[model samples]
Target: MQYRRFGKTNLNFSVFSLGTMRCLSSPKNVRQTLIQAVELGINHIETASSYGKSEEYLGEIINSELPVSRSQIHITTKIPPTADADKMRWWIDESLKRLKLDYIDCLGIHGLNTWEHFDFIKQKNGCMQAVEEAMADGRVKHIGFSSHGSLEVIIATINTGLFEFVNLHYYYFFQRNYPAIKLASLKGMGIFIISPADKGGRLYTPPPALKSLCQPFSPLELNYRFLLSDPRISTLSVGPAIPKELEEPLNFADRTEKLTIEEITIFNSLENHRDSVLGTEKCSQCYDCLPCPENINIPEVLRLRNLAIAYDMAEYGKYRYRMFENAGHWFPGMKANRCTECGDCLPRCPEKLDIPKLLEDSHNRLKGKEGRRLWG
Candidate 1:
């Protein structure tokens, strides 16, 4: 596996990082897959305290390995952000014991995914204080954060200049974090992209339209190459459930090359095709027509609409749409039915997207009674 300079940390991070979230089940197979990753030169592993049985798996593997073998790789684990300092402190101790390691290469505040989460991190005797105490004790080498929040919220966390690295979502289909990635690059913070194949448009089960766009390569591989093409990104998380799943990283061992001319052309072709299929009247996702009065996330809602219309992925679309149902700050408001047609975003939309009409169309297509049921 190829490596990249991990920002100011000066660590050489593998282009493919081993994400142990799926290791919760089938411990032996996953353990063997992890061992293969190390042999293939994947030197960094990321886990979280909440990921069941993951820490125990690592502890067993590391304990049986030679000291030199263990030293060759960096391990990262995270705790969710909370206002209670003592609980956060205890979490660190418990993590260390579970991993059976004296020190960890990186410790992240996982899922600082909203303004409310950020507030907890900054509160008196809160998450940050507990994290710093761990560092002071020499158990953690660097501080970082992982998020599933809004671009504004993630960027705000990066600007704090506290974390040495960051882990978040970014892929060909979801470029919402582009601005945040640019900021993290400027700060020389390591950027780890989370769940590229799984959450990244569900490429594991690619739609025919997307598969056609990727061409000769699998949608999964094409997406990996796409993310690696950006210099701002340090590494991508690859969660391998089976032994064969680990081989994809090895197949792309030569990650040094940039995006090929043919790849760029393919990308362009895909965009043009999407534009044609989505019709001339659609949200451009420019963010210019934002700051909705009802706190609706216009861009996110519209993107889902575009995917449903463009890909004919009715069930996938409706399932994703429902994720916003009661998600609170994480996903925000309901469908475009809540538009209220106040004419606030009318003039602001560059596409002149007949915003109210499109929202109605989306609601009519994706909502209840007639909507396609989720795949069995």
Candidate 2:
């Protein structure tokens, strides 16, 4: 496996780190998956306090079933932001107990996906203070945060200069977080790309159109190649559902150092096809159509519409579009059904696109039962 120097923390992290969110389906299956991942040179094992028995499974397997010493593997766990310093410290201690580890290599403030979460962390004697105390006492080594917030919020958090690294969403299909990724890289922070496959437009089971667009490379490999092409990315989290899921990424790791000419050609072709299919209806993501009276994310809604129409990504579009009211701050936005044909956003749009009509059409095309986020 290819390894990168994780920015400020200076840990040598595998390009494809194992995320243990879905690893607790069965103990034997999870044990084998974890062991296989370690055997394949994935030293970074990421879990969370909320991932339901994930830390316990890792604790049961690591140093027992896995062929590695305690010092060889890097264990990362996250705790949600809490205003109370004592509660934050308690969460940290609980994570350590579940993992049976003396020190966590990386401890992240999980789901910093809103200004409220950021405020919670930055409040006097809050979560950050507890994490600092943990660091000083040798219970935690490096500090970071994972976010699913808007670009503005993410950049705001990075500018705090408190975190050594960040875990956020950035994938081939979703490039909205690029600016935040670049800013974090400039800050000398480790950039861990969370859910490159699953949340990355559900590439594991790509739509037929997207699958065809990928050509010689499977959707997963093409997406991996696309992400690994950027040197700023320190690692990509691979949350395997089973042991077999690790094979493809392990094989892809052999060539992650660089993309070939053909792969580059495929990437360009994918972009061209998306643009051509989207035509004039493409949302440029200029944020000009902001401050919707109904609080709908106009650009994001239109972007999902474009994907559903252009790339036969209706299922993926529905999966996300339906998360409007359900995902809370993690995916903060109202559905396009609430557009109300207001003329306010009309004059702001530079593309001269029919905002109300398209939003209504998107609502008709993508609306469904609300979906739950994979995690908060």
Candidate 3:
């Protein structure tokens, strides 16, 4: 596997890191996948306190099955923003306890989705202070933050010169954070990518246009190759459902073939026609244009829309849509159908998605449908 220096942390991280979001719920599966990942030379594993039993599962594997030492692998975990100073400290200790580790290599503030969210971390008695305390106490080696916020918020956070690493949504299809990646590198901060594949739900089945563009190469390889082409990316955290999915990217890690100029040009051309290429229906889950003045969760609505159509899970989509619509904290002003096309959200979109149009389409189809189920 190809390894890259992880910013100022002084650790060489594998290009493909194991993400424990889905695997943690199944302890046996988690053990098997993690052991296989280590055998495949994937030494970096990322998890969160909020991702069910991920930490506990990792602890079990380390304590029971894996021969790997704490020094042999890098463990990255996160704490939620709602966790106050006391709560954050408690959670970090809990994470360490669950992982059966003395220290976490990197600890991030999980799910910083808005400007207000960033401000909350900056508060004296809030998450940042809690993280700093962890660092000082040797509980955490490096401090970081994971964001699904706008480029503006990311830039603001980077400029503060506080964090040792930053995790954000970045991939080939969604290059909105490209500049931020460079900026973070310039400042010597670790850059980690989250869910590049599952975010769009098309890594396994590339949109026909993208597949045709890639030709002989599988869509999954093309996706990982495109992300790895950028040297600034420290690691790509993949949420693999099984061992094979976890090992797929490792196959191409050390290969020498690179995308040619013409190939890159053709790929770039797809950007202009992305909606048609990837289908406007499949939400990339790039929640950049948020804090919707009307409080519409443009990304979540698009995700439900895609799930409804891609899997024919209209009832399931409607159920989730209703949850969001009814939850005052999530989506306030606008139901899916209530978007007025004010176009205020357009400029904020790094992906340049047409929000009003998407919301209208989703509400019309998903609300009245039945028998929707989760895709297998």
Candidate 4:
């Protein structure tokens, strides 16, 4: 497997890192997968506290079999922002206890979605204090954040010069975070990609339109190749469902051949196709311009639209939208119907999407409403 410099850090991490999200079901299975990955030379393992018993299971494996020395491998875990300072501190201590480790190689501020959330971390003294304390005490060697927002938020965070790494979404299908990744590289921050293949589900099948865009190569290989093409990307955290899933990437990594020019052309062709399909006025389902003024999940709602139209899965879209609505993650005031045509989000978009008009159309289509409604 090929290894790359992890930003400015002296460590060389494998291009593919094992993500433990799906490893919660069986401890033995998880252990075997980790052992196989390490055997194959994938030394970086990432998990999160939010992934439900994943940490516990991973802790069991490391304690039982894996060597405890820090030099042999790098471990990264996240602390969710929802936990207060004391609670976060307690959780980190518990995480160490559970992982049976002396210290985490890297720790990140988990699931930052908006500027407000970023402000909360930087200003409240709760999350930031805990992170600082963790570093000072040598419980965590480096600090970072995982963002699901725009380049603006990422730049803002980097400007603070507080983090040593960042985990964000970057893939063949979506390159929303490309600019931020480049910026992070320039600023000397470790870049870790999360779940690039399973973004819109499985790799075996993709949207017919998307598949057509990947003409010369299979969708799965095309996706990995796309990410691997960029030198700034340090590692890809793939959530392996089984040992084979882990092994498949190892095979891809072992091959010395690079993507051909034809493959590059085919991949580049996606730009036009994506724009044509999603339209200039609508969100591209990239989730970059998020934390809307009224709490609407612009990209997620648009994803439902795309799934409904592109795949003829209207019922699925409706079901998912209903779930979002019921979860109270979507603000009633920021419903597509509530768009006032104020035109605030257009300039903020990297895609230059026509936000107001798209929201107008989405509200009508999703809610079965006739006309526009104003946000008060």
Candidate 5:
């Protein structure tokens, strides 16, 4: 396995860190997967309080079943954001107790995905105070945050200089957070990409068109190479449901050398094909079509349309589009179904996109049963 210096924290993280959310299918499965991950040289294990007894199970496995000592592995666990300092401290203590550890290697403020969530943490005598208290008391070695928020919210959080690292969404399919990545790098913060295969357009179950586009490389491998090509990225979370699922990344994690010209060409081909399919109607995500009366995320909705049409990613598109009303601030936007045709965004679009009609098209193509988030 290859390792990178996680900025400011000065810890060396494997390029592929093990994510423990999906491995909770069974106790036997969890034990096998964790053992396999350690044998394969993955030293970082990430879990969250919301991941359904993941911390407890990890404590049991690491304390008894796993062969590695506590000093050989780095454990990262998280607590949800709360305004009360006492509650935040309680959450931290509970995480430590559940993990059967005296100190957490890293403690992330989980799901900092909204302005309100940010405010709750940054408010005087709030969660930040509790986090600092933990650090001062030798309970947490480093502090970071994970976000599924807009660029503005992410950049704002990074600007505070309170975190030593950040976990966020940035992948080949969704390059919208590149600016946030750049800013975090400037701040010397560790950058961890979240759920690259699953949230990254569901590349694990790639469509025929996408598979063809990434010839000679699996879509999963190409996406990994694309993210790792940038030196700024510290690690990518690989969440496997079973031990066998951990094997493929072992082959790809060490190939993080700069992409060859042919590989770069393949990346360009992907964009060109998507643009060619949309022609004049592609969303640049310029946010000019914002300030909608119904609070619809027009660019994101249209971007989903682009993927559904260009890449035959209907299942992935539907899964995300259905999260609009259900995900609260994490996916803060009304669905395209709420478009009142007020003509507010029509004149603002540079592509001259028939905003309402395209929104209706997106709704039709991508709407389905309400989707549930994997973690809260």
Candidate 6:
């Protein structure tokens, strides 16, 4: 596998790193997958304390790979953001014990999904102190954060200069984190993109249109290539559900694959098609038309609609659309059907889109019977 310099941390990270989220089952299976990944040159492994005994499984797996020193593996683990430094340090110690390791290469503040979580980490003697204590004790190396926060909130966290790296959600379709990613790059922070497959338009189960648009390579491979193409991105984390799921990217790396002319043509065609579909109504996602009394997040709804219509990613569109129903604060607010003919947003809309009408049609098209069942 090809290696890249991981920004200011200076770790030689493989462009493809392994995330132990999905295949953290039956120590034997996980061991084989982890070993296979390492043998295939994936030197970096990412896991979390909250990912269902994943650290424990890795503890067993890493030990089994004899002669492989802890230095060679480059392990990273994340804990939830806590206000109490003592509590946070307890988790750090617990993660080391669970992983059966003496030192962790990176410790991340996980799930910084709100401003409160962000501030919690910054408070004097708060979570950062725990990490600093660990560093002083030689138990952890670099510090970072993983977030599902808004673009604005994420930028705020990145600007704080507290982290050496950041774990975030960025893919071909979801460009909301573009600003944060750019800022992190400018700050020389390691940028690790999480959930590039499962949360990334479900490329694992690609629609026919996307599959055709990314020919010669599987949809997942195409997606990987797209992310890897961006030099600013340090690595793409692949959480394969099974061992074989590692093959495509591995083959690409082993063969040192580059985008062929035909593949470039396919990429252009898809871009053109997306532009055509969004003509005169491209959602810049600027949130200019917001604060609907119905409490709807108009931009995200329209973004999901664009995904459904632009890329034929109907299932992805439906899944995200239904999330608003029960997601509470985790998601923004009500669905598009709640737009009660208020002309207040029309004047604010930069695209001057028929907001209510587009929303109703999108609700009709994407919210199918399956979505209703999931929400119920």
User: Which is the leading candidate under TM-score?
Assistant: 5
**lDDT of each residue in 260-282, candidate 6, tens digit only:** 67767777887788889889776
Q: What is candidate 2's lDDT per residue for 165-205, written digit by digit as tens?
A: 99999887789898998899999999999998888888888
Q: Candidate 4 overall Cα lDDT vs. reference? A: 0.72
Model 6 sits at a Cα RMSD from the real structure of 2.7
Comparing 3 and 6 on lDDT, the stronger one: 6
Which pairs clash in the backbone of model 5?
none
Model 4 lDDT per residue over 216-319, tens place: 66677777877787777888887787777776666677543466788778766755555566665545555666657766667766765764554344544544
Q: What ranking emerges by lDDT with the best candidate at the front?
A: 5, 2, 6, 1, 3, 4
The TM-scores of all predictions, comma-separated, are: 0.89, 0.96, 0.79, 0.79, 0.97, 0.91
Task: Give the TM-score comparing model 3 with the true structure, all chains together.
Answer: 0.79
Compare candidates 3 and 6 on TM-score and give the better one: 6
Better candidate number, 4 or 5, judged by lDDT: 5
Worst 10 residues of 5 by lDDT: 367-376
Q: State how far residue 260 of model 2 sits from its true place (Å).
A: 3.1
The order of the candidates by TM-score, greatest first, is 5, 2, 6, 1, 3, 4
lDDT of 5 by residue, 48-162 (tens): 9999989999988886787788888899998989999999999999999999999999999999998889899789989999999999999999999999888889999999999
Candidate 2 residue runs with Cα over 4 Å from true position: 369-376
Q: Name the best candidate (by lDDT).
A: 5
Determine the C-alpha RMSD for candidate 4 after optimal superposition of all C-alphas.
Answer: 5.6
- lDDT for each of the candidates? 0.81, 0.88, 0.75, 0.72, 0.90, 0.83
* Residue range 295-360, candidate 3, lDDT tens digits: 776776776676555544455466556655454332333567778788988898866777788889
Positional deviation of 34 in candidate 6, in angstroms? 0.7
